[model samples]
Target chain A: MSENTTASTSPGVPVEDPTPFGWLTTADHKRTGRLFIISSLAFLIMGVVLDLLVRLDLTSATKFVSLDADSFAQSFALSRETLVLLFLIPAFLGLAMYLVPLQIGASNLAFPRAATASFWIWKISAVVLIGAYLGNGGPYGGWANGVDLHLLALSGLVIALLLGAVTVATTVMTLRSPGLYMDKTPPFTWSALVTASMLVVSLPVLLGQIAILYIDHRYGRVFLLGNYGIWERIDWIHRTPQLFIYVVPVLGVAAEIVLAAAKRRVFEPLAMYFTIGLVGLFGFGAWTNFAITGEGADIIDGLEGVVLVALYAGALIATAGLLGLLGLAVIQNRKLPKISTSLLAAFAAGKLVLTGALVGLVGAAADWLEIAGRGNDGNPQLRMTTWVTGQQSVLIYGAGLLGLLAAIHWWAPKIWGRQLNELLGLLNFLVIGAGALLAFVGPALSGLLTEQPDFVYADPNATSLYSNWVDDTGAEGLSALGVAGTALLLAGAALLILNLFISICLKKGTEATEDPWSAQSPEWLLPSPPPIGETDELPMLTSGTPLLDAQEENEEANT
Target chain B: MSDITPTLASGRPQRPRTQLVATGFASAVCAMMMAGALGFYMARRHASGPHPGSDWLDGLAVPNPQFDYALLTLVASLVTAHWALWASRRRDTAHAWTAIATTIVLGLGFINMVMYSMNRMGLEIGSGEYQNLAFATTGLALAIVVLGLLYIGLMGLRSLGGSVGQRGSTSLGAAVFFWDFAALVWAVTWYTVYVVK
Candidate 1:
């Protein structure tokens, strides 16, 4: 295909200006995508700083940062809120917005205006939530239960999440290249679609909870004050179903990276898609398991015990099946060259997800035994303490963040026309991986040792079973480990940033080629940082790996 | 240079259908929100016994005639909105414009009737949890209907200006879909809050 013929300007006539004003108003997917990523990164840095502060507080029994009990609670709450809501989700969203159109050969997002609106709304919500922290020490009700309590800042954050979800979902459903059918779409794009769908289903319930609470806070008590069941239900909806939401996209990211690294098509593309679909179905069904016992027993008593067990089993099985298929695909391919950073990170993410699933299964079994009256009553608290926190760390931070890092490394060239330093990429992975293990494991072990649940222990310095555990049983050592892990994680994050800055701003690297990784997707067919509004440059795809087909055609012609 | 028209332009034929699907999805989201609000209201209602506001439940207990009239108005507005969308698709510009104008008026009337009814009942949102639920459910439905009216009104203006016609009916169709969804939600809200004891 002739370059000139394929490189047409974006629809509705291209704007001429290239100033800041132009960028602010530009509906171009490339620019919008970058804005989402950069803003999310800024949020990520803030979240990491807050996380380090929380770890610092946990290092010793006494107040570490001159913070009171409420202030300490606020710190951890804000860190989680920032990381989960403002950082990780939006970072993936930015990647999807920027890359999905290019991957599918679409010139722009389906609703560019809506995409712009969504990003700004999210940014504003983050600011509002952070401002709430500055104003009144923020909503101390923990990130999962925060919005359900009806704080102004938390309400704004939920609304922002809702808008963002709608915008991303609409884009995936409506925008694709002319010939790119649903099954033929790239794995990352499919993951995005799944993530968006989950957001649509789950976020609204949270929004509703927030709305009701907001009305109560502003006007009167619509919901009963301190109703544990209501809070549990709301938290269950936001937290449990969301585990799959975070990991599904990462699975997609890892799949793409593994395929690229292995230099082979997915061994069973149809099975892979089927597994993804099953994962989504099971993800939705598993929300009941989170709230089925403990505080939620009263509210969810009507639900059959067998159904809850089935849901948990199904979610775990589906997740395992997905990971197994991906691993098999990678193992069967023999075209592997040197292992790239993307591949290593992808491999690590898969391991983390599998670990999370296995941990979840064990937790489920423990809960089953407790319900069956065969285990100690304290098992529920143990499940809440170590089991829940460990699973979240393994799934969200370990798997989700690693998957995103892989995407960042894999697509850096296509995103900014520059390559990340491979050594630094690997270093970032190792340091963060170690940090993640220590930070998560320390808490999990400490949680098991403690008699009380995680949330009940507001002040670690207080004279309680938790504090005794901290004082006696290696908990202090574990806290120190957590602090060390956090430091290393921060260092890893800084190195990743440094590498990008060196490559892009310092111009320390050579420009990337059109197909730096010999990738099979259509996106690799375009130049690194593919021309804006020129997505038509790619040839129409007849298969999932269009670039591979094109390479084969060229090879045949040359021979 | 080879003469190749970009697929982006060629893909225009599929845009309307995709947009329609998006509109449908958005409507589903709205329905979900309505369900969530309703669920919250029911939970609150059941969690606690009758408060001071339960006294006013007498109005809903007897099937007030005013509520029946308001529901009729809402149903009429939905019909006219769909009529306008159907007319627009057939390029019946005059009929479309008239039907859309009537729909907007009916929507405004419904909002007014809700406010009037709330006033007549002397129900303060702060009176009790039940009153609060009533206010929130009705207020949410009202806000959605107002949005629907604004959208349909804009389409009506566009039709009159000849900016929209048979070729540009997707926007009108989407607006109609939202209006119909709002009406359905209001029906559920009304029954749950006013009729269901």
Candidate 2:
């Protein structure tokens, strides 16, 4: 409960007495960090399991479960939506929300009790969401009024979000330790603060929309229906504001890694600011693209599409700016040694493989789009073909999957104080990467096959997802590759989970360690097992590495 | 830079005086938040087409009187936050506890009002878009206020008279201006463009 404002610690400062029922009553950031990681991984497992079910249903070309076509459709889409909304986003925030402020010198979150309460709210909401599956007509039906269950789920979601947002906002606004001002704050912290602001502003609007959705479901609320053009409003929420929630946080993490790894500050402050602004603005524009392209009297299908395309172009520019920063860092820091270990496998190998797969698929899609000559007018067949074959499998499964694996490996030591076996980790990365790359090729081949005349004997009643792909030989090959990827992915995922289990089982004597990455930072300078209160001494910052600076100072004093 | 060194020998840093100021500002904000929520609830009750026999020809019906109960709750929350700040500033242990006890009462008032408003609205998410905006934003704003009050209350437990509640109140007060202004602008524009138009 004591205030610890200084960044430095006094030597051998006494650790504060643990609070009564400390572990149970504790709201300490580090404990919260561990909980966040575990909870997110749990959600990830659930999402992956659902994904496996989806893939299995597609692979077998029959309803594995005794559900109608509509039910199947509803289940699949909802599963995809939930995977992102219910699982990934929440889980990612679990760590980021807890860790960012602490890393940036915040004493505690702005509102600690709210932080604890939000966790409960989120858990309850998750339960209600799962419970919605058992009710009247499942949680949602595609393009229909059966949205009440979802609305109910959202009520819980809004409560949770409000709690999470308030806690995070206050932490950012009030809890920063003395000397860490707006500018002096770490880069990661800056990105987090920006993201937190976005969340505070944007989440309420989303909650408002969810409220409307509840009405539409429960009481003939025609907000999104033909009457109010509610769908357009909902789409508005989706395109711009929604993108920031995901992108900004990822940018924050990337910025931290880039700056620390490159040993350089951000290239230009204005560029970072401009990039955040553009993303926020263009994020809104992208929603118009979600509008139905064909003529429904209410649809505003005119220049909105053109505007969306142009906005997407802006997104590319921001991405380029980030890449430019990365490139500049490379050129400037040729002397800094590249550190490698089994942990780097996911970052290095997974990325390389995922990149190669993206290239191949993109090339195939470009070729198909040109051949079909439906360049501006979106050809549904061509679009669906490309989606099922490549982007869906690659981006969703490859980049997302591998990136998470890498993050887990990188953060494990710091969080758990245990090292992953380097050989096993590298093997897991390779298996996952190979599986993803092979999976990408399957789609392009399906597209090529679709163009050929000799394609027949594919099942007629085999649903849009299956029938679309079966028509293309390239798609068929892609599906085959998908089968392999699925096997490999499952094996890899299982192996990773098994490794976690093994680590848990094999605990060593308690000791804390800092700078698990062997990197240079103030955090790393602390004693291996630092005191809980964080000692009252500050390292004199000569170089970026504080431990080295301290060692040098000691040597000079001795001389 | 000279202020970096602590004069207090107790090892606890001094509380920045602005914390008391922030408590004042946050209390006012919370009052507005409660008032807005009450207004929204009333507007909806009025809009639900005149309570049974209580009709007037001009069609300007006042909303649910139950909203007063909610407003009272919000006021209670504000007072608690204010007292926490006041007690901490004066180093008054007894009043700080009293303030905390009052905040809990206010928190209960808040919950009661939310439930009552939900019941009266009958789940149309507050009658219309403007009402909906009013209720949702007010709800979030109230939640923030409640948390702020609770934080101040908690700050009391850590202080045996060394100075725990210092730094960042003025900044927070500054932040509330932007936050409140943004909400007002967003709501006003939304009403003008979509609801009223």
Interface RMSD score of each model:
4.5, 8.8
| Weakest lDDT window of 10 consecutive positions for candidate 2 chain A | A452-461
Best by lDDT: 1
TM-score of each: 0.89, 0.65
What are the runs in model 1 whose C-alpha is more than 4 Å off? A1-11, A14-16, A59-66, A140-150, A221-238, A285-309, A369-380, A457-472, A534-538, A553-559, B1-14, B50-63
Predicted model with the maximum DockQ: 1
In model 2, where do residues sit more than 4 Å from their true spots? A1-24, A59-71, A134-137, A141-149, A181-184, A221-244, A251-302, A335-400, A435-476, A508-512, A527-559, B1-197
lDDT of 1 by residue, A1-559 (tens): 1111223554654542345665577667677788888787777678777777776665555345535565655666677777778777788888888888777766677777677777777777677677656654344343333433335555566566556566666766776666678888888888888877776665555555555656664564434442222334444542444576757778888888877776667777877777666656656644334332223332222344455445557667766777777777767875554587888888898778767666655555554555322244333344555446556667666787678778888998888888888888888899878877776777666655542244433242243323433323555676667667767767766777787788777877557887788887777766677655434343454456776666677789999
lDDT of each: 0.66, 0.47
lDDT of 2 at A432: 76
Candidate 2, DockQ score (0 to 1)? 0.08
Model 2's lDDT to the true fold? 0.47
Angstrom error of the Cα, residue B41, model 2: value is 18
